[model samples]
Target chain A: MWRGVTGTARMCCLESLTYSACTRTIWSWRSTIREFVTLNVGRFKMPAKEVSS
Target chain B: MNRKQTSISTCFSYERSLEDLFPLISSAGFTHVSLGAKEPHSSYLSVSRRGDLLQLLHDANLRMDSIHGIRLDLPGALSSLTATAEAAAFLDVPVIVVHASSFDFDPSEFDERLEVVLNTCEALAPVAEDTGVRFALENVLPGPATELVRSALERLPSEHFGFCYDSSHDQIGGPKPFTLLDVLGTRLLALHLSDRIRDHVDHVVPGEGFIDWEKLCEEIRHSAYAGPVSLEVLMNFSGFKDQVEFLRQACRQAERLYPLVFGENAAGL
Candidate 1:
């Protein structure tokens, strides 16, 4: 019973570490994509009203 | 180029006092004047006597369309600009034209220097707005300086900030005159129309130089700008009469070309 409890605790720790790392990688990619889109698309897309005004 | 829509800069007669220049412009058949804020005529600095100046202009039958801000002491640029704005407000002038940078500016420190200028303009933008005047930055040499001004305008993004298209400077500078007009578009608030020969800023008669006036008119017609096409020539061709005739003829040509460029009965005019 003691051995089983220790094994389960080690598995949970590994899973938690992998989950955190994957989340961070996904967020980093998301931010990069957001920046690229904003720079490329947003630059030419200044509101027409702004130009007229 | 209706005489009613035309203006002449007093910088052409910078040696004369405003008191003297007003009568000359009025006598020349020009109803509007672009007041110069330079020495001998640094009248814009006399903030307390603004009323007297206005009365003098009124007596001469000349209206102030704009104020040409002078560049003297580099450190005093902001103060001069603020005073000019005040003068513009008091006189009910709609625009104030300013030089892009000082004559003594170091090209090596262009960006850094431009940043400082931009900061000054940003600080003064609110004052301009409060006084119901627009600050139009005129293009000076090295060509790329205008791009710097455009960047500053973009960053500030105020209705009080715009571009003053100086034809002679644009011709001397790298960009084609019409291209600068196109780039400026609706941001164009004032004009310093003069002609140039090659790199020389001759400020000669309009059609007598390298600038293609027809193309300029076309570009202006396409743009939303509808303001005075003010002449800023420094030299009189022969005498004051000849110079006035030359400007009057140029205005006629511009008026004739307007319909050709923008089609008949364009509403914006």
Candidate 2:
């Protein structure tokens, strides 16, 4: 029973690590995509458009 | 010789009319102001109202040294240019600082877009010259906009065309900010002094952010620019007094560092 408990604990720890790694990767990509959009496409609209509209 | 005068942008408090803000600026010991060509306060669309604004400035004992030109894309750009030039002429302002471009074109369309911008500048250059005003194209970031302006300056070769270097934009604009002063040299007509923290374009007070004002002062002193360092800081009413004092101190620090960085003769001390 002790051995089984130790095995389950190890599995839970690995799952937690994987979850955090995935979260970090997603956040990194989110920031990159935001910057890419801003630099490559966001500035096309004129400031006047926002003012006039 | 007297030290180069310091000016502040009206963008600091756009909600406040010239009558309300000019006194505050004068009280802060700023004799010169750069009028922002936007809504509610100093609108280029309401160029006819410039007479009243001029009266307010005159009453406040402040001078409108320059204008931050309106940003409009083609079809409307030429008309806006005319209005801005007219306003500048009416106010007797010498420089009308404008953005090179506001659009984000694809890398594939870079050359074509640049050609369009250059042609537009070419068409507007003569208008600026006729009105006794200089078109100082301000640098923006995340692309080759500055280089494009440089090319436009080369192709046009007009005395009316010049550059307005923005420190905050340059901080995020890939290249080192001071290097731009070296590149533009005598073509530099005006400055938009602000600070940025890392990739964020904060426009915070000079020393509060990551900008090295000492080094930038040295670069400006070494360069051919002798104009007022105008602050294009973001608006914050509660801390307005602190911001004014901060800019005053920054200008004083630049003045003190000028001789140290460039020596007596170069600094004209």
For candidate 2, give the docking quality class from DockQ.
incorrect
* Segments of candidate 2 deviating more than 4 angstroms: A1-53, B1-4, B37-40, B44-47, B173-177, B236-269
Which stretches of candidate 1 lie above 4 Å from their native place? A1-53, B1-3, B37-39, B71-73, B103-107, B173-177, B236-269
True contacts kept of each: 0.00, 0.00
What's each prediction's TM-score? 0.71, 0.72
TM-score of chain A of each: 0.75, 0.72
Residue B141, model 1: Cα distance from true site in angstroms: 1.0
DockQ comparisons of all candidates to the true complex: 0.01, 0.03
lDDT of 2: 0.69
**Candidates' interface RMSDs, in order?**
15.8, 9.0
TM-score of 1: 0.71
Docking class of predicted structure 1 = incorrect
Error of 1 at B183 (Å): 1.1
Per-residue lDDT of model 2, residues B1-269, tens digit only: 54435577877667667778778777665657888756456664586688887888898877777787765235677778777888888887888887766634456765876777777777787787789888887777636665666766767664888888788777773336577778786787777876665554356556656788778877876766656566667634113356556546645544444454455565232
Error of 2 at B5 (Å): 0.8
Candidate 1 on B133-215: residue-level lDDT in tens?
Answer: 98887766634566666766677665878888777767664336467777786788887776665444356656666777778
Lowest lDDT 10-mer window, candidate 2 chain B?
B235-244
